[model samples]
Target: MQALTWWRNPGTKDLDAIVCDGSVRAGKTVIMSLSYVLWSMTDFDAQQFGLAGKTIGSLRRNVIRPLKIMLHSRGFHVKDHRSDNMLEVSKRGKVNYYFLFGGKDEGSQDLVQGLTAAGFFFDEVALMPESFVKQATARVSVEGGKLWFNCNPAGPYHWFKLEWIDKLKEKRALRIHFTMQDNPSLSPSTIARYERLYSGVFYKRFILGLWVLADGVVYDNWAAETMTTHIDDVSGYESYYVSCDYGTRNPTVFLLWGRKDKVWYCLREFYYSGRESSNNWDDSQYVTAMGKFVGTIKASIIVDPSAASFITALRKAGYQVIAADNDVINGIREVQNAMNNGKIMFADDLKHMFAEFSSYIWDDKAADKGIDKVVKDHDHVMDALRYFVFMVIYKQRTATTAKKPVWLR
Candidate 1:
């Protein structure tokens, strides 16, 4: 509310911009949109304005739809221009014009150019291209006009955080950070559900509402006390799955998972790191080790897609092996989601897997080179974990739980 006042009544303070950064489902968007509309209508009559989102669909879903409902409930006469996709609002003999635009990509800047808006509102500004934001800001050249922005936090180095919000001078801008707690309408269960939806960078940005760097430790949610446990019994499990990453020189990792009552527990791991070995181990050695480890347990085996030799070897040894989904980003996301939701627990004996999780990090060079990837070092066990989560657990859970499952190749 104070942040809204900083824009609604910017008396001697002379502020022209308001930024609200926060967690999802916070009351920031609705309240700020209401305030922006009402204040604009009161301050400037018959003025041209603009509202933008990542896309037209999102703009309508996030802002225009709810805003129209709010306006009608308050007895304001709202007229739509279907041809231009705009709205002309009038109340108590006063009128204002609002144009809707999308900044879905960097190329979207051309659409917002040449407009002279009295003010503008940007939804999910952090997800927008920097060029589009600059173009939109330039369009709002009207005197005494302010810019309104609301977004979930991104990396600390994200342009919106580094340039506009962080460098903001007194009176020039009012920046407010919000969390799920700020919204009274959200129930405790709803908040917890949201918290479970993200992990690692997404957790930091979308849950905690912090602008932290997405650099090190891929699974930052892992802690020995909370996530790792010792379980001597597997009799309660309804089924089991095994995931393996076949590596000769790098490492070979096989993780055993047991599921009971919707919870997946990491029961054991058979790891072989050849970092210090003079001779690279053969596929037969891993196959022999795996056969001994399982000891007649009937579990569906998922193996690395690239390891045809290992796959053939496993099948020859009387084990059913399905090729694991190796889509790196999506796989990582599934594993992280499992960890975030407390659906996955690791056995205390899987020390190597824990060590790999701690060292896995985003590849800065690859990011700069226009590719999103994680560092491939010491990630053998991590890869196996990702494969299990992405292929089996996530697929099953989302099929039943989500409205539309996020499918990965």
Candidate 2:
């Protein structure tokens, strides 16, 4: 409530910016966005402003849709120019232009260049590159221009934390921290369900809303007794999938997965080390071996994005192939969450994957430099598992429709 009235409050009117950082589903984005729009429409007119997110699609989905509804309820005229990626808003014969931008990468700085903005609102600012944020902020040259930032907590050494968040007083910015408790709409049971979705570093950052380093074992929740199931116990599988990590000189791995009753089971695995074997298979050879390994099972195959040759071979051999999403840190978090929530399990016979889990520790050297990276050794099966859980299961969990596999169709 204070954050919403900061601009009107005499004591905080002089602040140049507002930063809201907290847990997921903590009601930060909606409030921050509402406050920004109200502040703009009330204090400024016939001017230009900026609304940004990590990507334009996300900005539209997360902010624009709900924001438009809120404005319409209050009798404001809103016009969205999709091709131009801009919004025209007016009320009481007062009009303003709000341009949308995506600060996804270093190149995103160029998109915000050459435009003068009266103010800037960044959603999930922590996910954007520093260059893009700097460029966007620089565009706010209007005399009374202010900044608004909202995001979940990331690493302790993130650039945003060091510059904007840690220096709130120096930057003359108001900072508001929130948790699930702050959101009145969420019930105790709903909050508890979300709380059970994460563990380890992800739990500290996303659930507790703390800026902490990711260290130690990546999947600390993995235990043979609890996380593994015997193959005989798995039945009624509705869909099957194969996730692969292809390597020429290093080890290659393939993990077979099956879904039953909203839970995924790693039913089987195939691991081959080119360096350790007498025969190093080519792309076609690996494809042949994979076909034999997956014999008679109609399943969609998810392969590493970088394996062009292997992907081609698999596709030519009549396999439906999907290029896996390779966002390492996020993928690891999704995999860990799946394990923690009991959405995924491993078959007891998959010894290689179980062995790899014990060695899949966070890179301490990288952590020391404020980066979250997993150790590269003994990670083939681990990578395959991550691919399956993140790309297949995570999407299935969030998607409104559970589409059947091509083979099933």
Candidate 3:
């Protein structure tokens, strides 16, 4: 209502645009859409308005559905034309029209190229291409028309943050920030669930509503509390695989992976360090520990390509061992992508693995030199993870008989 009140009197509020940004599902979209559509009824008569999102599908889901519900309650009937992607609202012999445009890519600039709208509402504006945003902004040439935008915060250097959002001035624009707390309907448990789903840069931006940089962490997608679970029951898994990273002075880490429904779970982990072990473990002793780790289980053991001695020992012990694919950048990308898509999970017992993920950083010198490399310190478990993802999981992805996987080649 405050936003509506501000928009109600153009004489009092001279802002040309209002940008609402913050956490996800925070009632920002609902308020903005209701206010924009309702204000357009009295503010502009018998004219077409604009509605945009990353895509037409998203606009329908995020803006059209809820707005229709609100309009219906207010004695208005709304009609959506799916064929042409347009919306029509009618109430007591009055009607307003809206055209949907998708701002998903740079080419989207042409999608709204010639539109002259009374006003516009853009959802998730941060994800839209700058070219499309600028082009769409120019199309709202009607007098008293304003652009309304709501989005979650992105990287500090995101174009939206760098451009119009940061240039807010009195009467020129209104900038409002929201958090999950803004929505009283959201339960505490729901909020806590969202809190556990993001970590590092994601937490800073989505949960805390800050425009932060994404330079430090490599596996920025991991959330230990949410993605890690106890793997006491493994009957659900169709198969299992193991990957190892052997080090004498550093930590020798082994990761056990279980698969179900195309999703991979790091079920358990075994860590042994020559320095940490009181007996000063050798390859044979570590191999004995590895044997106990996967006792009486049908599993493939993938070993580090460099660990020739360990591989020979594992093979001699009647275990199936294969040389792991060690393509560093591709392996990192495979793991990162899996994490981003919520496809990789870890068991809660893998404390060392969790700690490695939490502290893993990109190689600063390599990054500065335009090379993507991770800092090779305390990354024993991470290396094991990469080998598993790249050699085992990625190979499975490509072996499918249907259309080839997009990530394959």
In terms of TM-score, the best-performing candidate is 2
Give lDDT per model, in order. 0.83, 0.88, 0.81
Residue-level error in angstroms, candidate 1, position 188:
6.4
Instruction: Give the better candidate number (1 or 2) by lDDT.
Output: 2
Writing each residue's lDDT as its tens digit, candidate 1 over 80-196 gives 785796889999999999999898888999998889999999999987899999999999888878899999876666788777887778437778889999998999999999888
Task: Put down candidate 3 lDDT per residue, 221-305, tens digits, no spaces.
Answer: 7777778777897656888998999987678988888988777899888887777765566789888999888877778898889
Q: How accurate is candidate 1 locally (lDDT)?
A: 0.83
Give the per-residue Cα lDDT of candidate 1 at 104.
Answer: 84
What value does the lDDT take at residue 44 in candidate 3? 72
lDDT of 2 by residue, 67-155 (tens): 88778788888898889999999999889999999999999999998999999999999899999999999999998999999998887
What's the lDDT for candidate 2?
0.88
Candidate 2, poorest ten consecutive residues by summed lDDT? 400-409
What local lDDT score does residue 394 receive in model 1, on the 0 to 100 scale? 75
Q: Can you list the residue pairs that collide in candidate 2?
A: none
